[model samples]
Target: MISATELPSTRPYLIRALYDWCSENGFTPYVAVKVDASVQVPREYVQGGEIVLNVSMDATSSLKLGNDFIEFKARFGGKPRDIMVPIQRVMAIYARENGQGMAFPVNDDEVSSTPLTAVQPEPVQSLPEDDPTPTSPSPSRPALKRIK
Candidate 1:
């Protein structure tokens, strides 16, 4: 049995929340995923081992955002395709219009060390309180501003 302290990653829940937020605000939600053998996406559309998908209602059909994976039927090049993406493979989920979203870190070493089947889901935890104000801006990346 998994201990309570060994909680499941909040990535999936965050993704779902952001997706809902985008949809509610009439913004398009996009997910950036790292493609691997486990990901069922169009190889041709995947660029540099990564693919960004629009998870909006019109783009996807019968989209099931599960705890471990997101499964949906989408049209690619005018052909219907079933897409499956592991929550672990999801790097980021954001709105296309304002670039407001969250990014999850990817540890290449951990990916190589662990097997996908060994992964398990636990209960979700609450996020800690943090100031929304931006302190300093890094030159490499743009600063994130909270949207109303």
Candidate 2:
């Protein structure tokens, strides 16, 4: 018999499925990642430690959605860069056109601790005509501010 700890994470499988779904339906697949020392991406484009990536087949090259990590090469400002994000650090994966996708609860713990679930509401900036790879998503703040 296998224990819960022995099971692989459902996150990677779901991410691949969503990517396929978006591809089959002509929707752009975007992944929102919580940036840390482990995540490799452009710091200048990252807004408040979070970055939204356009993972569509048209945008990325040598894309590999693996079990432990998502590896790909994409262009930022027309300069190609290798992007890598640990599967557990992904905050959400959704269709950029319709905002229809799934979100995972990202934390320091392992992905197997909790089952995959629906996505979160993170607003993104409108895409530009020439550049649509790195979307500047405003960071989310759950706390309210005091105003006079």
> Which lDDT values do the candidates have, in the order given?
0.78, 0.80
Off by over 4 Å in 1: 1-5, 111-148
True-vs-predicted CA distance for residue 41, candidate 2, Å: 0.2
Model 2 CA deviation exceeding 4 Å by range? 108-148
**Scored by Cα lDDT, where does model 1 land?**
0.78
Candidate 1 lDDT, tens digit per residue, 1-148? 8864566667778899999999999999988887888789999998878889999998999999888889999999999999998888877889989998987655444553242333333344444568555444334332233222
Best by TM-score: 2
lDDT of 2: 0.80
**For model 2, how does the per-residue alpha-carbon lDDT over 1-148 read when each residue is reduced to its tens digit?**
9766667778899999999999999999999887888889999998877888999999999999998889999999999999998888888888888888887767644443244343446655677789869853445432221111
